[model samples]
Target: MNERAPATSPEVLAAGYARCAQVTREHGTTYYWGARLLPEQSRRHVHAVYTLARLADDIVDLAGPDPGPATAAALDAFEASFWDAVDTGTSPDPVMAAVATTVRECGIDDECFTRFFGAMRTDLTRRTYDTWGDLLGYMDGSAAVIGEMMLPVLRPGTDAVAPARALGLAFQLTNFLRDVGEDLDRGRVYLPQEDLRRFGADPHARVVTPEWRALMAFEIERNRRLYREADDGIPALPGASRRCVATARVLYARILERIEAADYDVFASRARVPTVRKAALAARMVTSREPMRLVHRDRAALDPLGGTWVSDDPVVLLDDTGSPVGQAPKSAIHHDDTPLHLAFSCYVLDPAGRLLVTTRAASKPSFPGVVTNTVCGHPRPGEDLAEAVRRRARSELGVEVHDLRLVLPGFRYRAEMNGLVEHELCPVFVGWADGDAVAPDPAEVDDVQWVPWEEFRDDVLAGRRTVSPWATEQVPLLAGLGPDPRAWPAGARDALPPAAALGPAAEAA
Candidate 1:
């Protein structure tokens, strides 16, 4: 079973995601590689869900001599814990915690889990499916719900659900054909008994006779029909999701080609899609869909503030402890009476240790034309603060900065100018870029300066240069870190006092 390291820190969640990623990459190569196309948020949730399902499947299929009531009891206990986690927004079990978080964040219904476990419980008692309808009935929970659970994470349009189920069934039916011999060895036959009798393919014989080949050919065609039914739903998904599902759909469909290549001899050996083939197909899908993604990138893209942050996009509302409680529209924030919310500030430095500073565009907003750090941004709903900063760096400064370290985790301040307010729990980050010359986006930045760290600090401290109120407060602290941004310690965020509690400093500014 995949295990999560205990802790609720950001580092711990990052570590948990990594562990789940390992399970995905090592155990489900085709699915994992396909998942690589998703955005980070969607990809991690998919990994968590896959890890959960794999754990449950292991209990049902690999319990060996304990595959009776004992296995059933363990599964029941697991389901109970899953529900508990769902209700509480957390779980002591690492895998469940991740799954529960995804379910909560994505708004997936709990009914999907109930239906899935119902099918898993049936695995202990059911042996042979009597007809196609019976096989499909079992597959509904065992297979279709897998696709239903993924709907929220995929964010495909609602009309795609039925097709998603069909696609899932197609994949599961292909697996049944491939695993016929293995299932028979376990005293079960996943193939419907009516199909076996119709094709004269006896489950007891376990041989690749003419009747078996004919039967396999028929079942392969049946699965192919389901794939075609699923093809219609691909357009309903977002670009990255479309690419991901397309890759998985195409790769799984190739299993039929492999089976055919072996003359339908699934019983002799398991027919598998080669790793090389999977890679080639995925590459083709990615390249083919690349242009479409670029066309749609701007509308869904994160702004320089590290969020959609348009006039209508949601800004995360923060509680006293800096935990998110709710959200308000971006246009509704930044007034004289603005509420305390989560925000971020980033400082970008070049390899030569020169700091990149910018003056905000004089587009007539609050603090317009004020000189500040490289760029400051706010987190979008459900976005990680660090990730948002990197996005803002790229979108605003047109510079790629790496290894950003949070320098002030408890940073907060409230300043009012005219009728505009700047009240934020803004964490600070320091990042290193490749060169001193950064291409600034004219819409957000009016002027850019790359100044020696010591010179900039001296000017700010000597009161020889005017800057934003927040910048005035931060420059002194940044100067204490010495010249090289890369040489900054990992515990930098601990060096500063809580920004919100600095009442005197705010008053002076």
Candidate 2:
């Protein structure tokens, strides 16, 4: 558990947030645990906003003694008072006080609050939505606005809003899926009526019938797509904020897994992710090398180290023909055991035209302590080879490369070291470093040094230095081309092997 050291603030603001934070922790277990991944300053603000939303929600749904009209009137009054307090920069109500402080401090837009309350007002009268678009209209205000509100705390790029909106809708839809039975008990069905009819599902059919199962599966797939779309924007955020959002995304999405585990019997039992599992997931993020990688895999290509080095991370599994047949956890790939896959080797050169070389960390499973090119990486499913080269350079060496040129597209190799095999139809790239200093990530490289290209070639040829078998063939071939990368012979740039040509013959060669 992360401990927050007490710091003094304006008494009213601090007291307001303290109360809101407690409310957040007590009710929203999954969100509370995920928010804990954020820095205390941002975390408190998130709690305050969530508390404000939760309070309004309670007024609409949990004002038990009041009828619908009374509840609606109460909600309207609460909104009016909350906004008035926000405008005046003070609120006697504890929740509003926290909300005011958070909005002012984080520079949140009042328009976001306007949109959120609009959705809350809808819940009063709307019993059933007719189409997917209508539900989306409802969620735009209800769910998407929440994502918009939190963007300031997350601090992602301006382009982040679209994905943030998708993620919010995904989270809200997951709740709808999990709470189907509970929602029914409250005389409501959150799933769109049109979708229900399209799938031959009857809202009144309380049992998990086959039609209902099919419908749930369809909706689950839809939600998964939304989650993927939302995940694309997470990396644009700051590091800690990315982790916090990623943590929340993974844990919340796991509820769908729970529902599936129970055979889509969300009605019989509400899918709940336990607090212990939530803690373990958060702990895993802390220990994992690339914590910024989000819950979704397709969007993970943008993450520098998302698919490399880490065993459980997924890599594109290619058939002998170099076409992506599927993906496998990287840990599952072993020497000669798994089919040959597509990979890329990148070499970086300083302004002086010196090539960077790195020793594989001793802890690496294969070729440990062997020297290699600046870095080697496997492209995620559908990732471009040149893009992968640049990604690995940044992740492993903490350096950026410009104008990566695929110098040897037909490069392929198969070598066995210790018990593991090295077989790849790997493309070779050359890129100039953006700066002189190379900061090596210790997990990936044991040591890094820049050596003149000619000197490195001579050392490798003379057996004065140990190099990975792929590099053994590659470095000398690169040296044959010459000193200036831009001036390298055009003949050296072979066309990449077509998918059909990457067969066992290439592997055995």
* TM-score, one value per model: 0.55, 0.57
Clashing pairs in 1: 305-378, 412-499
lDDT of 2 by residue, 152-189 (tens): 88899657999899889989999999988777766677
Candidate 1 lDDT tens digits, 1-509: 12233234565567667878898988777678779889999999989888888888888888752378889999999888888777776676666777777778777877888889999888888888999889999999988888888888899865789888988898899889888888877777998898789779985787779888878876776676577667767788888998898778777877877888998877789888888887877777778845234222322111212222223557778777776678887554654346788777888888777889899887635577799889887777776666777778888888887767766666778885543578888877787888875788877888999987777888999999888888888888776766666665544433333322221111111
Full-model lDDT, candidate 2: 0.76
TM-score, predicted candidate 1 vs. hidden true structure: 0.55
Instruction: Count steric clashes of candidate 1.
Output: 2
If candidate 2 were superposed on the true structure by all CA atoms, what would the RMSD be? 17.1
lDDT of each prediction vs. the true structure?
A: 0.75, 0.76
Could you tell me the TM-score of candidate 2?
Answer: 0.57
